[model samples]
Target chain A: MGEFDLIQRFFLEGQGRLAAGDEVPVGIGDDCAVINPTPGMQWLVSSDMLVEGRHFLSTVAPERLGHKALAVNLSDLAACGATPRAFTLALSLPRADEAFLAGFARGLFALAQAHGIALVGGDTTAGPLNICITVMGEVPRGQALLRSGAQLGDDIYVSGTTLGDARLALELFRGTVRLAGDAFESVRRAMELPQPRVALGQALRGLASSAIDVSDGLCGDLGHILARSGVGARLEADALPRSATLAAQDLALQRLCTLSGGDDYELVFTAPAARRVEVAAAAALAATPVTRIGRIEAEPGLRLFDAQGQVLPLALSSFDHFKS
Target chain B: MGEFDLIQRFFLEGQGRLAAGDEVPVGIGDDCAVINPTPGMQWLVSSDMLVEGRHFLSTVAPERLGHKALAVNLSDLAACGATPRAFTLALSLPRADEAFLAGFARGLFALAQAHGIALVGGDTTAGPLNICITVMGEVPRGQALLRSGAQLGDDIYVSGTTLGDARLALELFRGTVRLAGDAFESVRRAMELPQPRVALGQALRGLASSAIDVSDGLCGDLGHILARSGVGARLEADALPRSATLAAQDLALQRLCTLSGGDDYELVFTAPAARRVEVAAAAALAATPVTRIGRIEAEPGLRLFDAQGQVLPLALSSFDHFKS
Candidate 1:
C-alpha cells in the first residue's frame, strides 16, 4: 500500500471510532475539515514543530515521540487558556514502519482522549522524520489569558513545579550527569511524557493576568511575559519548586537546571497579589499544584534573589537552538 | 541569534500591519493567536507538508518555495469553498540563512496579502528543510461544497488547465526530457509557483455539487471524489484540456504527463448538467476558465475514452510519497 493508503487504514479509518460531535461538520477525507464553533466564542490556534535530532534523540521510542509531539502543541493552548477542540498533524517519516505508526498513534490518542480532543485531518509524507501539529481550541470572548496582560503588582506563579527532570534526563543521556535507579527513570518519564496542564489553564482563564508554558525554561519564558507586558519580575531562588530528584542535586546544578534547563512544559503565570487565594483554589480545583515564586515589578529587567536573601545578577541565558 | 530571535526579527516584527478586524484579537509573539470568527460562519482548517528532496530541489528559489508552501495549503481551503482567514507556518531549516528567509517570507506574504490571510502563529526549528502550513478559513453554514455531494448524472469539470507543465519541468530538471526557450520557462513557472484556485472555489460553492483540488494527478484526485460520492466517472480524452506547452508534446508523453503528473493545484469539480450555464458563468466571474471533460455514473469504477471514442486502459496512478 502507498503512504496514503497506510494513513487511511491506520489514522483516518481509526478516527471513525473517535466519537464524533457537532464540532466537525465534515471530518477527514476532505480537502479541509469544517469546524462549527459556538457563536460569540473565540478560537485559538497554534503550531509547533519537532525535528528528530533537535527535539529528541533518534533512538527515542515512537510512542514517546508521538506523545511529545501532541503534548507540546497542547502546551501552547494551555498557556493561552484554550480548551482544545481538535488538532491536525503533519508528519514526515523516513519510512512507513507499521509497528512504529501503531505505537505512535496509541500514545497520541491516549493523551488526546484524556483531553477530549479529536483528530480532524492531516497529511503524512516520507522524509527526514519530523512531526508538526497545529491544535485548535476555544475560549470565551474576553476570557483568554495573554502574555501582555501582566501588571506591575501581579504575583508570578508556576504550576506543577519548575526545573523539570527532562533536562536531567538529557544530561544523563548525554553522559554529562548521572543518577541512580528510580531517580533516573522518574526523570526519563518526566522528559518523555510531560503532562500538558489543560485543566489548570482552563481554571486560570479569568484569574491569570499573564501566562506562558515553560518549554524553553522558566527564566526565558517568564522573560517573554515581562517583555510583552512592559514589566519586570523578581524571582526568589529559594522559592522555586523542584522535584525531589532535582533537589537532591547540588545547589549550583539545581539552579542551572531550574534557570536554564528547558522542555518542562509547565505553566508560569502572573496574577494580582490580592487574588492569591483564588489562584490557590483554582489550582486545587484542577488538581495541579502551583506555587508563587516571584512578583512583577515596574522595572524592565529580571532579578533573582539567591537563597542567602542576596540579590544576584541574572547572567544565565536560555538554550538557543541556533547557537547549538 | 537564536531561533526565537530570528522569528522575532523576521516574522512577528513584520505582522504589525495586517488590516486586523475583530477576527484576529492577537497575532504573533504569543503561544496561540486568538481568532474571533464571524458569529454565523463555519471555520475550515487544512494543513499541507512539503519536504526538501521530495517536493523541490536545492536550486529552487527560496521565494518560490515559500509561495508554493502556503499556496498548497490555500488550495485545500479553495477546494472547500472557504475564504482564507489566517495561517501558521512550521518551518524546519538546515541553517539560519537570513537572505533566504527574507525572500521566502516576502513570497509567502505576497500571496497571503492577495488572499487576505494573516500570519497568526508558528514555530521554527533547526533540521532538514521542511515547510508545513496550517491554514484556516471560513464558509457559511451548510454552504461548503464537499466531495460526497456528486450525483450520478453530474458533469465533471476542471478549472484552468491540467497535466500542469510542473511535470515537464520536473522531467527537464532530471534530464529525462528537454525543453527549449519559452516552453522551459513556462513549465518551470508551473512547477515553482502554481497559484491556489481560491477564487474559483468560492465561486463554485453553490454552483458545483462536489470539488477537489488537483495535488495528485486528476485521475487519482478524481478517484477520491468518486470514492467519497459513491460513484464513478467516464472521462473523454478529446475533451480534456492541456496547456499549449503540453499539447505540443507527443501523444504518449502528453497522456502520461496529463494523466499522472501532480502538483497542478487546479480545481476538479462536478455539477449537475442543468447548472452548466451557471457553472460557466461562475467560472467567468472568478476569471478562471473551466472545461467539462467527464460524466459521473452509478458504476463503481473510472473509465477513460481515447480520441476515437475507444475505451482507454487505466494505468495511471497518483504520486505516492512513500513509494517514491
Candidate 2:
C-alpha cells in the first residue's frame, strides 16, 4: 500500500474523521491542521516519542503499543492541568502491515474517543517502528500547573491508590521476578496500559501549587519539582503508595518498587497544608484517590525518612534513555 | 549523557532557549509549552517525519539533514500561507553522538532563527535515527489558502524559477546521471537545502485560490489541488520549469526530472486568470520568481500537452514511501 492509502484506510476513516468545529476550523487532509484558539484560553503543547526496543519490547501487541503511545503524551497534558483537545501522530513503520495498522488504529481511536480528543493530523513513513505524538490542549490563562510552583511547607501528594505495578511487570518479564497466572496478567496490564489523570490534574488546578506526572519514578520525578520550585522535600518513604501485591513483598522490595518504579502515569502534585481537605475533595471529584507522602522544605536537598523517622540511604536513579 | 543533560547542553542553551513572550508564555522545561494565540488568527499546524536511509542517504551531512528535516515542514506552512511561529522536535538517535547533535542543532537553529520561529518543546529518545517536527504557524481567519479553493478557470503557477535540480542531483548520486564539478555541487545543494517560499506564500494570501508545496513532485502535488478542488488541469509540459543543469540533459531525462522531481519544496498554486499582474507583483515582493505553466479545467482529469498542443502519454508517479 502507498502512504496515502494506508492513512486513508486506517486513520482518515472513522475516529480520525472528527468534525471540524470552532476549536479546529480545519483537521487532517490539509497542508496543515488549523485551530481557532478560544478567546480566554492558552494552548498547551506536549510531544513524546516512542521507539521500538527502547521504549517498548518487541513482544508488545500493536493495539497496546498504540494505546501507550498516546497515553504517555496525554499524561504530559494532564500534568499541566490542561484539558485534552487534539493530537498529531507521526509514525514510522517497517511496512504497511494490515493487521498491525488495524489493531493500532482501533486501540488508538478507542482511547481518543474516551477522552473526546481528535487525531487531527500526522505523518506516516516506512522505516523502523517509531511513534511520535504531539498533543495540543487548552488551559485557562494563568491557571496552568507548573513544576516551579511548589511552595515551602506544601504537602506533596500522589494520585491513584496503588502504583509500581508496571515496574513489577517489567521485572517479571525480564525474569528478575516471578509471578503466576492472574497476578502476572494483572501487573502486565499495568505495564501495557496507564490512565492519564487528566480529570484530577484539572480539578487540582486551583488547589495544587505544583504538579508533574510520574514517568521517571516517583523520587526522580519529584526531584524535578523540587529543583524547579527552588525548594527541597522530605519524603516519607514508608508512606509511599503501592499495590497490594507490592505491599505483600519484602520491605526493601516494596520501597524499591514504589520509590524507583518508573512508568507510573499518576500525578504527583503539591498543595498547601491548609488545602488538604480541599485536595481530598478534588481527588474525590475526579474519582482518583490520593495519598500524602511528603512535604516541601525550605532546605535545598531531598531527604527520605523511614517509619521510625530514621534516614534511609538508598540511591535511586530515574530511567534515562541515553545513559541506560 | 542522560536525556536532560543532552538537551540542556545543546537544545536549552542558546537558540533553543527562546524567550517567553506574548505568543508563548511557557516553553521548554514545562509539562506542556503554552501558546497564547493572537486573537482572530487561526493556528496552522504541520508535522513531518524523516527516517534514516528512507528520507535521505546515510552519506548526507548531519547539518544538511537537520536543515532539510525542518524545511520540509515549513514548506507545508508556506503552502497554507501561514507565518511561522514555533515548532517542537521529537528525535530518536541510536546513540549520544555529540558531534552529530552539535551539527544538527547548529543547522536547525540557523534556519529557525532566520524564520524567527522558536523551538518550543520536544522529546528525545535512544533508537534508530528519526526526526519528527511539528510546526505551528498562524494566518488570518478565512484568508489561509487551501487546495480545495481552486476555481475552474484558474491559472496555475509555481514559485522558484529553476526547479528539478534536486532530482538531477539524486540521479547523479545514484550514478544514473553525470555532471561537471560545479554543476554537480550546485544541484546537490538544491537537493540538500530547499528554501521554503514563506514570503511568497504570505504575499499570495488573498490572490492565490489554492496552493500546495511540491514535495512529492509537481505532477503529483498538483493532482492533490485538482482532486480537492474537484477540477481538472491542462499542464503545458514544455513550459515546466527546470534548472540550466537539468535543461542541458537529454529531453527524456529533463522531462522526468522536471515533471516528477520530488523534494522540490516550492509552492504550486492557482489563481484567477485576470490576476496575472497581481500574482507577478506578489512574486516580486517576495523576491521569488514564478512561472505560469498550466490552467484549471472543468473536466475531472489531468491532461498534459506538449508545445505542439499534442497530448503527451507520460507515465508519471510520485514518490511513495511504502510502495517504493
Candidate 3:
C-alpha cells in the first residue's frame, strides 16, 4: 500500500480520537494539525526515537514495541508533571506490512485511549524499522516540575517502590543471568511494557521540589537533578528499591542492578522534609507507592552510604546510546 | 561521545538560540520544553521523517540532507499559513561522528536562524540514519489556510515558477538523462536545497482559500486539496511553470516531469478569481513569483487541458514511498 493509504487504514480509524474541542481544532488529514491552547496553560513537548536492534529486539512483538515507543515519550511528560494531550508519530518500516501495522496500531491506540490522548499528525516512509514520536502536553503556567527546582536538605523519593526488573530482563536476554520460567516472564513484561507514572507526577506538582523519570538509572538520573539544581545528594545505597527477583540475586548484583539499572520509567523526585506528610498524601492520592531513598545536600558531589553510614565506592555506569 | 554529549556539543551552543521569552520558557535541558501560547493564536503542528537511502542517497552531503529535512517540515507549516515557532528533532545515527554532526548542525542552524525557529527538545540514539522533526507554528485563531477551504471556480496558483527541476536532477543522477555542467548544477541544487515558500504562504493567508505544499508532485498534492474540498480542477498542462532547462526538453518529458515531479517545496493554493489582483500583490510583497495554471471545477474529478484546450489523458503517477 501507499503511504497515505497506510495511514488512513491503520491510524485514522478506531484510535483514541478526541472530539473537535477548543484545545484541538484539527487533527490528522491536514497540512498541519491545529491546536487551540487553553488559557493559562503552557505546552510541554518531548521527542523520542526507537530503532530496531538498538532500542528493541528483533524478536519483540510488534504490539509491545508500539506500546514502548509511545510509553517512553509519555514518560518525559510525566517527569515534568504535564497532562497527556496529543502526539505525532513518524514511522519508517522496511515495507508496508499489513498484519504488523494492525497489531502495532491496536497496542498504540489502546494506551492512547486509556490516557485520552489523540494521535494528531504523523509521517510514514519506507526504510529500516524506526519509530519516532513527539508528544505534546500541558501544565499550568510556571507550575511544571523541573529538575532545577531541587533544593538542599530536601528528601529524595522514588515512585513504584521497586525498580531494576527491566535491567534484569535485559541481562537474562543477554545470557548474563538466568531465571525461572515464571520469574522470567515477569521481568520480561517489566522491560517490554512500562507504565508511565503520569498520575503520581501530576499529584506531586505542588509537592515535589524536583522530578525526573528514571529512564537511565537512579544513580545517573539523580546526577542530572543535582547538576541542574546545583545541589549535591547523599543516597542510602541499602535503602535503594529493588524487585523480589533482583533482591534474590547476590549482594553485588543487587546493588549494581538497583543503582545503575535503567528503563524503569519510574519517577524520582524530591520534596522538603517538612512536606513528608503532604508527599505521602499525594502518593496515596495517585495510588502509586513512594519510597524515600536519599536527601539533597550542600556538598558538591554525590555520596553513597550504607545503612551503617560507610561510604560505598562508585563504579557504576548508566546506559549511554553512543558510549555503550 | 555519548548521546547527551553529542547533543550538547552540536545542538545547544550557538544555534538559533531564542531567548527564554513568554512563548518558550524552557528548552532542551528540561524533560519537556515548555511553550506559553500567545493568547490570540493557535498552534499548527506537523512532522516529517527522512531515512537514508529512501529519502536521499548516501552520496549526498550531510549539509544538504540537514537542510532538506527541516525544509520539508517547514513547508507543511507554510501551507497552513503559520508563522514558524519551534521544533523538536528525533535523530538516530549509526555512530556519533563529530565532523558529520558539525556540518549537519551548521546547515540546520543556518536555516533555523533564517526562519527564527528554535530547536526546543529532541532525542538521539545509535541506529541507522534517520531524522524526524516535529515543527510547531502559530496563526491567528480561525484564520489559518486549509485544504478543505477551496471552492468551485477558484483560481489555482503555485508559488515559484519552476516545478520539475528537482526531478530532472534525479533523472540525471540515475543516468536517464544528461545536461551540461552548469545546467546540471542548477537542477541538482533544486533537488538538494528546496526553499520553503513561508513568506508567500503567510501572505496568501486571507486571500487564498486553500493551500498545500507541492512535495509529492503537483498532481498528487493538488489531488489532496480536491479530495478534501470536494471539488475538481482543470489544470492547464501547457501553462504549468518550468525552468528554462526543463522548457527545452521534449514535450512528453516536460509534461511527465512537471506533473509528476516531487520534492519541490513550493506552495500550491487556490483563491477566488476576483482576488487575482490581491494575490499578485501578496506574491509581490513576499518577493516570490507565482503562476495561475488552473481553475477549480464543480465536477468530481480532475481534468488536464493542452494549450489548444483539448483534454489530455492522465497517464502520470506521483511518488509513493512504498509503491515507488
Candidate 4:
C-alpha cells in the first residue's frame, strides 16, 4: 500500500463508528476539513509529537502507539477542561504494513469513539516513525480551567494515583529494574495505553481553581501550576497515593518513581478548602477518585514535608525533551 | 538553549505584532490554546508534514523551510475559502541552533504576520528534521468552496500561472537542468518559498463552484476535484498560463513542469460559464489574475487537447511519497 491507500483503507474508508452526528461537513478526502462549531463556544487546540525511539520502544505494538499519540493530545485538552470533539493525526512511517495499520486504526478509533471525538483530517508521509496529533475541543467562553488560577490557601488535589506504573515499565525497558509476571504486565499496560482524565476535568469546571495534567512526574508537573499561579505548595510526602504494586517496591525506588516518574497522564488540581465536599461530589460524578495532598500558599516556592512535618530537600528533575 | 527556551526566545517572547486583536485567550505557556470563534461560522482545519530528505534538501535554508511548512498548510485552508486565523507547529530538530531557529522564526512569522495568523501552541522535540503544522481558519456557515460543487458545464480556472517554477528548480538542483544567474535564484525561490493563494481562494468562495490548491501537480490535483465532483474535464494544453522564464526552457521541459510539477501552491477552481465576469471580478478583488484553461464535462475521464483540439497522450506522473 502507498501512503494514500494506507490512510484511506485504515482511517477514512469506513469510520462509520465515528461519523454519526459529527459536525464535520467535509472530511478526510479534502484540502481541509470543515467543522461546524457550536454557537458561543470557544475552541481549544493542542499538538503533541511522539518520536519512535524517544517516546516509545521498537518492541511496542502499533495499536498502543496510535492510542498514546491521540491520548497525550487529549490529555492537554483535559487539562484545560475542554471536551474532546475532533483530532488530526500526522503520521510518518518507515514503510506501509497492512496489519500494523489495521491494529493502529482499531486502537485510535476506539479511543476517539470513547471520547466522542471524530477523526477530522491529517497528512500521511514516509519517514522514520513519528506521530504528531492535534486535538480540538470546545469550552464555554471564560469557563476554561487554567494553570494560572491556583489561589492562595486552595486545597491541592490529584486524580488517580500520584504516579502510574508506567515509569516502572520504562525503568524495566531501560534494564534498570526487573519485575515479576503480573507486575510486569500491569506496568507495561500503564506505559503503553494511558487513559486521559477528560470526564474528571469537565467535572472540575467552575469548581477547581486551577488544573494541569501530570505528564511529567508529580513534582515537576505540580511545579508548573505553582509557577504559573505564582503560589507555593506544601506536599505531604507520606500522603502521596501509590498503587499496591508500587508499594511493594523498595523505599528509594518507590519514592523515586512516585515522585518524579513521567507519563502518568493524571490531573492535578486545586480547589477552595471550603469546597472539599463539592470537590468530592464532582470526583464521584466523574467516577474518578481524588486525593487532597496539600494546600497552595502565598509564597512562591514548593516544599515537601514528611509525616513529622520536616522539610525535605529537592533532588529530582522533570523530563525535558531537549535538555534530556 | 533547551526546547522550551528555544521556543520562547524564537517564537512567542516578542511576537508583539501578532498578539494585537488575536482571538487566542491563553497562548504558548498553556497546555492548549483557547480561541474564541465568531458566531455563525464554521472552522477549517488542516495538517501537513514536511520531512528533511523527502520534502526538501538539507542544503535548503532554515528560513525557507519554515516558510514553506506553514505556507503549504495555509494553502489547504485557502482552498476551502477560509480566512487564516492561527497555526500550531510541531517541529523536530536534530539539535537546537540559535541562528537557525532565529532565521526559521523570522521567515515563519513574516508570512504569518502578512496574513494575521498567530502561532498559538505546539511541541518541539529532538529528532531528525520534521515539521508538522496544523492550521485553523474560519469560513461563514454554508459559504465554504468545495470540490464537490463543480457542475458539468463549469469552466475550469487557475490562479497565478500553471507552472510555479519549483519543479525546474528541483531539476536544476538534481543536475538535470541548468539556469543562469537570476533565473536560477528565481526558480529556487519558487521552489523554496511558494506563496499560498489565500486571498484568491477567499475571493472565490462564492464565485467558484469548486476549488482546490495545486500542490501535487496541476493535472493530478485537478483530478482530485473531478473525482469528488463526479465529473471530467477537457483541458486545453496551449491555454496553460506559463511564466516567461518557463517559456525560455525547452518545449518538453516547459510542458512537463507546467503540466505535472508539484509545489505550485496555486488555486484551480471551476465556475459556471455565465459567471465568467463574476469570476474575473473576484480575481481582481484578490489582485491575482486567473486563466481559463479547461471546462468540466459530464464524462468521467480527463481529456487533454492541443491548440488544434487533437488529444494529447498522457505520459508524466505526479510525485507520490510511497510509490515513487
Candidate 5:
C-alpha cells in the first residue's frame, strides 16, 4: 500500500474507545502535530525503545508489537500520574511491507484511541526493527506522583496479579503451550498484549506516595523505587498475587520466574497505611484488583518473607538492557 | 565502563549548548528524567529517525551522528515556531562501547546546551546503529506556524545557503575532496552538522504565514507546503542561495544536488508580502541570512525559473522513506 493510503486506512479512522479534546488541535496527518495547552495542566512526556530480538522475538505478531510498544510507554506516563493526551512514534523497519505496516498502525491507533491519546507526528526509516514512542500526557503541577516520594512505613501495592505471564512463558518454552486452544491462546494473549493501567494510576495520584511501572520484574523494578526513595521494602511472599496460570505451574519454578522474569507491565506503588482502604476501593472501581505485597521500611534493602515469617533472600535479577 | 558509569561519565556531564528556559528538573542518573514545563506555553513535540547506511554512512563520526540526530528534530520544532526545551534520545547500538557512546553523547550534549535544551529520558538498546530523538519545545497557543497556513501571494524565503552540503557529498563520494585541510574539514563539518535554524524559526512564529524545515531537499519539502496550503509556488533558480562550496562545483550538478539532494535541515517558510522587509531584517539580526527564493501562486503546481527568466520545468525528485 502507498504511505498515504496506509496512514488513512489504519490511523485516520476514528477510534471509538477514547474521547478527543480541543487540546489536540491537529491529530494524525501533518508534518508536525499541534496540541493546545489546557489551563492548570502541564504536559508530561517520556519515550521508550523496543528493539527486535532484544525486547521481543522476531516471530512475535506485528499487532502485539504495536500494542506492547505503546503500552510500555503509557506505563511510564501512568507512573507519573498523567492522563494520556498524545504521542509520536518513530519506527524503523527493514522494509515497508504493506501488511506489516497496516497491522502495526492498527494496533497502535487502537490503544492510543482507547486512552484518548492522539497519534501526532513521527518518522519512518529503513533499518532493523526499532520502535520508539514518545508519549505526552497532562498532570497538575506538584500533584504528579514520583518514585522519590515513598515514605517510610508506606504500604506497597501492585495492580493485577504477578507471575501469570512468567508461567505462560515457561509453558511456551517447554513446548507444552499450544496457541490453538482457547485457554492457551488467552494466556499467550495476556503475555503479549498486557494492558497499561492508565485510569487506576490517575486515581492513585493523590493517594500513592510513590509509583513505578513493573516492566522489569517486580523485584528489580521495586528496587529502583527503594533506591530513589532512600527506603527499604519487606514483601510478604504469601501475599504475593500469582494468577491461576501460575498456580498450575511447578511451585518452585513459578516462584523463581515470578521474581526474575520481565515484561509484566504492571504498576507497583507505595501508599500510606491510612489511605489503603481508599486506594483499594479505587482499584476495585476500575475493575483491576490491587495486592498489598509489601511495606516501606527505614533500611535501604529488600527482603522477602514466607507465610510463617521465615526470611527469604531474593536475587537482584531482572532484564537489564545491557546485560540481557 | 559499565552501563551506570557510562551514563554518569558521558550523559550526566552536560556539554551541549542549551537555550534559555530549557532546564531539565531531573536529568540523567534517575530511572526517568523529569521536565518542568514553562507555564503559559504549550509544548511542541517532534521526532526523527536516522539510521546508518540509510541516513548516513557507517563511516560517519560518532559525534556528527549525535549532532544530526538532535539537530534534525530541533529543525522540526523550529518549523512549528517552538523554542526548543528538551530532548529524549533512544539509541540502538550494536554493542556497548564507551568511546563511541562518550563521543556521541558529547556531540548531542553540545547541541542541547547550545539550543538551551536538556537531555531528558530515553532508552538504550542493542541493535544496528540507529538514533531516534524526540524533542520538546514551547510555543504560545495559536502561534505555532504550520505548512497548511500558507496563503496565496505569500513571499517564500529560505534560511542560509542550500546545496552546500549536497555538493560536499558529491565531492566526498568522488574521493577528490581531501579532508586533511581546514577548508575541506569545514566542508565535511557542514555535511556532518547542518545547523538547524532555531532562532530564525522562533522569530518567524508571528511573522511567517507557514513554515517547514527543509530536510528532504528544497523542491520536495516546499512541495509539502504548497500541497498542504492548496497553493502553487514559482521558484527562481537565480534567487536560490548557493554556498561558495557549491558554486565551486559544476553549476548544473550543483543545482541538481541543491534542488534534489536531502539532509539540509534548514527552514523554508512563507510570509505576507508586506512582512518581507521585517523578515529580512529579523533574519539579519539573527545572523542567518534569508533569500526570497519563491512566491506562492494562485495556481497549484511548482514552477522554476532560470536567471534569464525562462521557465524551467520542475524536476520533482525527493527522498522517500518507502521508495527504494
Candidate 6:
C-alpha cells in the first residue's frame, strides 16, 4: 500500500475513543504527529523492540505481530498511569511489499486509534523484519505510577485472566486447536490481540501506589515491582484468575503456566485497602474485571501459597532474557 | 565487562552541564527515564534506526556507532526546532559482550548528556546489532520548524562541513588513511561523532521557514524538504562546505562525495533574507559555522551549479532506501 492509503485505512479512522482528545493536531498524514500536551501534564515516553523469530514465531500472522508490538509499548504507558497520546514507529522490512505493509499498518493503527494515539515520525529501513516503536503519553507530574511506589499492606491486583496465551500455545502445539474453529479462534485472538488496560490504569493513577504490565509473566514481572519497591508479596494461588480451558489441564501445569507464561499484556497493580472500592468502580466502567490476588508486605521476598495456606516454592523464577 | 559494569562505565559518567531546573526526573537507573516536561510545551518525538552492515560498516568503531545512532534522531528534533530533553534506546545485539555494550552506551550517554538529555527507557534484545533511539524534546505550539513551511525566496543554509564522512570512508577503504595519525584523527572524529546542531536549530524556531536534518546525504534529504514544501532549490557547489582533506581530493570525487554521502547529521534549513543576520548570530553562539548553499524557488525541481558558474545536470540522485 502507498503510505497515505495505508494510513487512511488503518490510522485515521476509529481514534476518537481512546483518550480524552478530539482532533489530533497532526495525525498520521504529517511527517510527525503533533499533540498539544494538556497543561500540567508531563510526557511519559517508552520504546520497545520486537524481532521476528525472537519476540514472535516467524509463521505468526503479520497483523498479529504489528498489534502486539504496539500493545506491548502501550502496556508500559498504562503501567505508568500515562494517557496515551502519540507514537512513532521504525519498521525494518526484508522487503517492502504492499500487502505486508498494509496488513501491518492496519493492525498497528487499529490499536493506536483505539487508544486515541496518532502516528508521529518514524524511520523506514531495509533489514530483517524488526519493529521498534517509541510511544509518548502524558501524565500529571508526581502522579505517573511507578514500580517503586508500592508500599507495605497495599492490595495487589491484576486485570483479566492469566495463562491465557500459554494455554493457547499449548493447544496449538498439541494439535488440538484449529485457528478457524470458534473456540480456537477466541483463544488465538486472545493470544494475538491482547488489549492493554489503558483505561483501568489511568483511573488507578492515585489509587494504585505501584503498577506493572505483565508481559514477562505474572510472577516474574511482579518480582520487578517487589524489587524496585523494596517490599515482598504473598500471592494466594486460589485467588489467581485462570480460564476454564486452562483449569481443565493438569492443576500443576496450569499453576506453572500462570506463573511463568509470558506475553499476557495485562496490568498488575497495587493499591491501599481504602482505594479498592474506587478501583473496582473504575474497572466496572472500563468493562474489564479486576482481581485482587495478593498483598504487599514489608519483607523483602516473594511467596506463593496454596488454598490450604501451605507455602509452595517455585522451582524456577520468571523469565529472564539473558538467563532464559 | 558485565552488564552492570559496562552500563556504569559508559553511561554513568561525564555528563555535561545542564540548564537550570533541567535535571532528569528518572534517569539511567530506572526501567524508564522520566522527565518533567516544561509546562505548556508540546513534546516533539521522533525515532530512527541504524542497522549494522546496512547503515554503517561492521568495521566502524563502537563508539562512533553509538554516537551516530543518537545524533541522527537528535537531528530530527533539531529539524522541528525542539530543545533536547530525554531519549530512550532499544538495542538488539547479536551477542552480549560487555566491552561492546560499554562502548556503545558510553558513546550514547556522552552525546545525550552533552545535550542535557536523559536516558529514559529502552529495551535490549538479542539479534543482529541494531540501535533504535527515540528522542523527545519540547517546543511551543505551532512554532515547530517543519519542512512544509518553506516559501519562495527562502535562503537555504547548512551548518558545518559536509562530505567529510564520505571522503574519510573512501580513504579508509583504500587503506590510505588511518585513525591513529593526528592528521586523520579529526577526519575520523568527524565521521564518527557528527554533531547535530541542537542549539542552532532551537534558535532558528522563529526565523527558519523550513528545516531538515541531513542524515541521508544532502541531495536525498533536501529532496524531502522540497517535496514537502512544494518548492525547488538551486544549489551553488562553491557554497558547499568541504574539509581541507576533501579539498585535496579529485574535484569531481569531492563533488560526488558531498552530493551522495550520508550520515552528515547537520542541519539544512531555510530562512527569510530578513532573518539572515539572526541566523548567523545563532550559529556563532552555538559554535558552529553556517553557509548559504541554496535558495528556495517557486518551481518544483532541484538544480546544481559548479564553481565555474556552469549548471551541472545531475547524473544520479542520492540514496533512496525504497527505490535502491
Q: What's the C-alpha lDDT at position A279 in model 5?
A: 92
Score residue B106 of candidate 3 by CA lDDT: 74
| lDDT tens per residue, model 2, A106-192 | 788888888888877888888898999999999899899999999999999998856788888888887877887888888888888
Please give fnat for model 3.
0.98
**Can you tell me which runs of candidate 2 are displaced by over 4 Å?**
A1-4, A13-16, A316-324, B1-4, B12-16, B317-324
Per residue, candidate 1 scores C-alpha lDDT tens digits across B1-324 of: 566567655764477336345778788878899998987899998988899887888899999998999999999999999999999988888888888998898899999999999988888888888999999999999888788899999999987774558877887888878888888988999989989999989999888999998887889889889999999989886677788988888876777677668888889999999999999899998999999989999998899888788987687444333132
Ten contiguous residues minimizing lDDT sum, candidate 5 chain A:
A12-21
- Tens-place lDDT per residue, model 5, A208-260, is 99888877678877888998899998988667677666667675545555665
| Structure candidate 6, residue pairs in collision | A1-A98, B33-B120
Error of 6 at B158 (Å): 1.6
The residue-by-residue lDDT of candidate 6 on A1-324, one tens digit each, is: 345334433433324223224434544433344567777776677888998766777766778877888998898888888888778787777776777776777788788878977776677777777889988787888788888888989999989964555445645745754444555565666677778888888888778898888876788889889988999999986677887666666666566667766678788899998887898998887788889989999888888998899998764344332132
CA lDDT of A134 in candidate 5?
A: 89
lDDT of 4: 0.84
Candidate 6 or 4, higher TM-score: 4
DockQ of every candidate structure: 0.90, 0.89, 0.90, 0.86, 0.58, 0.53
Winner of 5 and 6 under DockQ: 5
The TM-score measured for candidate 6 stands at 0.88
DockQ of 1: 0.90
Clashing pairs in 3: none
Quantify how close model 6 is to the true structure by its C-alpha RMSD in Å.
4.5
Runs in model 4 deviating more than 4 A are: A1-4, A16-22, A162-164, A316-324, B1-5, B12-22, B162-164, B316-324
Candidate 5's error at B276, in angstroms?
A: 2.4
What ranking emerges by DockQ with the best candidate at the front?
Answer: 3, 1, 2, 4, 5, 6
Residue A138 local lDDT, model 1 = 93
Native contacts, share recovered per candidate: 0.94, 0.93, 0.98, 0.83, 0.54, 0.55
TM-score on alpha carbons, each prediction: 0.97, 0.97, 0.96, 0.96, 0.91, 0.88
Docking class of 3: high
